[model samples]
Target chain A: MLTAIREKVLAGKRISDEDAMYLFASDDIFTLGALASHVAYRKNGRKAFFIRNRHVNPTNICVNRCKFCAFSRSQGQEGAFELTIDDIIGKLGKGQATKAKGMGKSRSPRSVHVSPHGFSEVHIVGGLHPDWPFEHYRNMLSAIRKRFPKLHIKAFTAVEIDYFSRISGRSLEDVLRALKQSGLGSMPGGGAEIFREEIRNRLCPEKIPGERWLEVMETAHRVGIRTNATMLYGHVEDLADRVDHLSRLRRLQDRTKGFQAFIPLAYHPKNTEIEGSYTSGIDDLKTMAVSRIFLDNFDHVKAYWIMLGEKISQLALLFGADDIDGTIIEEKITHSAGGLSGEKLTAGQLVNLIQKAGKVAVERDSFYKTVRVYP
Target chain B: MITQEDNSRISRKEALSLFKNADLLGLGMWADMARKGLHPEEICTFVVDRNINYTNVCINKCTFCAFWRDADDADAYLLDRETIFGKIEEAIAMGGTQILLQGGLHPNLDISFYVDLLRSVKERFDINVHGFSPPEICYIADASDLTIRETLSILKSAGLDSIPGGGAEILSDRVREVLSPKKIKSSRWLEVMEAAHRLGMRTTATMMFGSIETPEDIITHLDAIRQLQDRTGGFTAFIPWTFQPGNTELEETGRVERTKGRTARTSKLRVQSPATAVEYLRVLAISRIYLDNVDNIQASWVTQGLKTAQVALRFGANDFGSTMIEENVVAAAGVSYAVSTNDIIGAIRTAGFVPAQRDTHYNLLRFF
Candidate 1:
């Protein structure tokens, strides 16, 4: 029944709620893959996408002690530190240093993977600095834009915005407007852990509550910023939680086609108060495929290898994912938590991976712009 | 070569049929019935080493996890090198051969941290430093500002033995989006894996299923692993585990009211259940039966415990997984499934199969 419903849905047929449930719960993993694959083929075709962006997590400082975080620095600790605005700009300015160093230039000298297409977007996210107010972000965004106006900037998670609004004593709308005028392109889909509050109360402790997280995203969509959605898996969540996470994203997308993609974050349980076995590789794949099946309203599903590791990320392509994210020249987020994937990728390397997975690789911008097509 | 040609034109239905009735080829009744071909001893083996992820103070607070420390959290920590050194030093003393050392994407650490650790382990003791998944590799490459090849080279020079294939969920982007909105994607993951294989690092392929995927998607994951194996023969074994939902963000997202009777809907465990013996059978049988390019399919007695793991053997599984000695990840998910080498031998023997100890690559450790 679920298989038939999946076939009907993929054939441009509308499926009921019961049907959706059956489709997601089917025992046949291949059937899941096939339905998700068909949907992927219809939406994005054979094109796999990545981008040439730099992750600008300038400060690892944060006040929230969300249980799911393996990254972030306290106000002052052994390695606790913050990137000065100059330091932040200096990092982004390395796009030029990147050029000078030959990041994209095949014969260039810089040691990172330089894509054929140069950096197209700058991912601007940082821990919500307890001291820095909304204006601080304004100044930061202004400085970044003043320096690299051409680069589209996608910054701030829902949690950050919620915090920013409270700090600035304004509404989310006012804050979003101010940030946008200052050149905020879109939002990053962080803070939407599992939508179930029971887990949220226990795990996240202090994130924007599940509803507020969606409220922010839906609000952002209303204001015209296409954001992405995400679900952290493999630890402390049930399949229903997984389904509900997708269901929320799907419903929101139904109202405001704002989510450009979905990402499955694999939980790596290292260095936290909550100690447990991490999600197995099998669990990760199941999450990825099910996300694809449930999130029919979303356009693209990304398999971020930075967390999933490489082999499973590659395997994700067959399950339902289409975009492989970008080659971040220098990423700051993963390292603080003991990240293993070095913070950059090149066009050549990206091409090889997509091809190796039997797909075409393309570089994309923040708004899902086609920057370079390696296929 | 001929099989490749055949596979090129094989229909999905034909491939699906293998999930049901394909011959397991090497280790079970069919291997005995047919003229003896590939010997089990010759095939690469999988290990039972405990994956000791000592820290979760990751800079990469990816969206899919719920088990990491907020840098400011009182619970955040980093293990003293002594504890780590002791962890491995003891594992080796207890007949363990490898250590899978993967941490969250951390920041501020440099090459020296990893190199020093690798060197200390290599010089003081002789063990395979099968640590650092590709995501970790990506982090290393970014921090040192070296190409992945360059970082891998430095690690190799510093006595890095091999790579542990972890963090690979599904390679598909559609799946990746809902899971982790901010990490590396399918392409980069594969790129790093391929680069490692090219750089002479042996890796394993794994799939974490049941929480949010389909059976066909499961096949796709296996197929992806098989393709890479065909190309590099770098993967030593294939491992499949069910999702364990405990304190993750995904768990907090949605819920449905539960009812006692098995009516229209029933509340179920989040990850795939190991108790579904038939499901495990089909998956195990299909893995051994279909992943023609792969050599060993590990029995996840760790996830399934010993009994189902024993059942997996007849379902085409050959090797019993870890003596783990010590495991932190699965234990976090509320599973206390642990077994000693002697217990494993007894289980395998009880299941009517020979028990043997093997190395990281399935080579017999002088036969049991």
Candidate 2:
């Protein structure tokens, strides 16, 4: 039965929902991987993609607490923290130093793999501060841009964008346009817990609705800001829900062609309202592979190494993942949720991992530009 | 707590359990971790060897074979010493470090013929002579009216440096009976290999999968090799290649030629399609994780082509099998992927690895 579906996929026909369901339920992982890898090889050939960027989560304060979030907190909670503009610039400067140290660590004297202009992008996404006005968000981007104009600013998830629209009394388009004008280069894929309304209502009812999040992303794309998409899986969702979530992203990609990558974020149930163990490596690989198979129009599929540790991320290359987010200097969102994988990987480590996976390690900038190809 | 540390020990049960239940990606993770632990540096190894099949005449007409010819067939001509010596000379000039000499189990060939051939090759060229799989060794023993140990002793004294692990289609006798009943039984193949190992001769092990075998049968095969390696530690590497039923009797039948189901309990082995690249990598990765005592796992590029073989290096294979200047067995089986030395190095470099040349004993000879 899987052979039949695999033949269809080889023929370039889209697999049906039933085929996906069967694949999810079947124990024949290699067959599904074969199909997914077939699609991936056709799409990208042997090149595996990654980005060289830094992650800056500005604040942890939020108005609404999503059940699966381990990073959010009330304004005065015990562990809540926020950064001022100067503090962020300081960290970005420090991050530059750290990345420099990464490239200069006791290592092979091969050509340096970092971009000529170091730190290609600054990835900024964080909670919605109840008291912070719209200008705080706009000023944050302006300050970062003012300090480092060359760094592409990928900030503000759709949830944050929707929240900004609500608090600032602006249309979604107006909010996106304002941020873009303030040096918001693109959007990050987060806060998209699950697309199904049932799951959304139970877990993150106070957050933007699924339709609203999609609307915000579509508005951002309309304003000429490309973005990435993500799905938080391995929680209260079925196989049909996963397929449905991906299908929604696929439909949007077909319309706007704005999504540069699809990242399947594995749900880490540490210190969250929804209590559970971490998803197994098998589940993580399957989710990544299935997303790659479903989102044919999306150009890249990323295995965010922050959540799925280093080894599994390396293995993910053969299982339909073409991107391992980046050499994230520091990560707090997943860390707060009991994520134990280190906060950062050195530039040399990233190149060695990709190369050892028998893939050409291509260092990419924010818009998926080839920064360096570590062949 | 299997951290990415070197020499982290895992029990056979744990390894087999992973092979049975772990997802393909999970298995790859374990294998890659192991690979990293074993080879912390950025080196992948290959050898430059010419596969010199001395003759094509055979008595064991295995069902999956496409290379054997009848004794009276017009093409069934054995190479004399001069032709063989000229081939070796050409190989030496082309930078070949060894020669992989294998052939069908010819019925009329006596033990003296093999001894003379080995002596002639050694007398001519200063190259490693890795020849004679276990089945071929067993055939020579029976024809010479000697024990397997005696046969290996004679061949070793006559300049056979090591043995290549061929003719190990599937170690499970149940599957072996249906695939190649005329070949040496599973135990005899192992016994020949073990005798060679006891003689302090290193030999590689191989598994020809994707035929009439279940996952359990694969485990069985791996378990056999693992146990033997544990005892002697003489096995240098393990190579797993998919059964290419292209021009063979298996392809002609369109089904397994014997029983539909080998056992009443087991489901019929499907000959509908060959194992895909995914299956090949799965087996390769699992073998690396399982056979901890074995140091190297080679990629069978002749059957899988360059792309999959390149990918296999990441999965588990630390060594590329050979640069077959002339290979007839798999080529006759109709799935040949010819690659030159430059092509191999380019593929390895493009795949982000440094390609080094190794000899039969896996000693690094040069790095390109």
Best candidate (score: TM-score):
1
lDDT of 1 by residue, B1-368 (tens): 01324434344455566554442222233322111133343222335465678677776543335445655668676777889888887788777887878777767677788999888878887777788888788888989889888888899889887787777766666666555545667777778878888888888877766456666676777777777777888887777765555444444322221111212211222332222333444566556645766666777877666655654554456667667787766675556654677667656664546677777767777344
Error of 1 at A196 (Å): 1.4
lDDT of 2 by residue, A1-375 (tens): 778877888887777777777777764455566677788888888788877788988899999889999899998899999999999998787655333544445354453543322467889998889999998999999998888878789998999998898899999898888889999998998878798999998888898888888888888888899999999987888889988888888889889999988889888877999976566555776777778777788889998889876656776787788888787787999998977367887666677767756678888888777877887
List of chain A TM-scores, every candidate: 0.91, 0.94
Instruction: State how far residue B209 of model 1 sits from its true place (Å).
Output: 27
- Candidate 1 chain B: minimum summed lDDT over ten consecutive residues — where? B257-266
lDDT of the candidates, in the order given: 0.68, 0.81
DockQ for all models? 0.03, 0.02
The CAPRI classification for model 1 reads as incorrect
Off by over 4 Å in 1: A14-27, A98-118, A338-340, B1-368
Residues B237-309, model 2: lDDT tens digits: 9999999877566663433433222343223333545665557778999999888889999988787766467
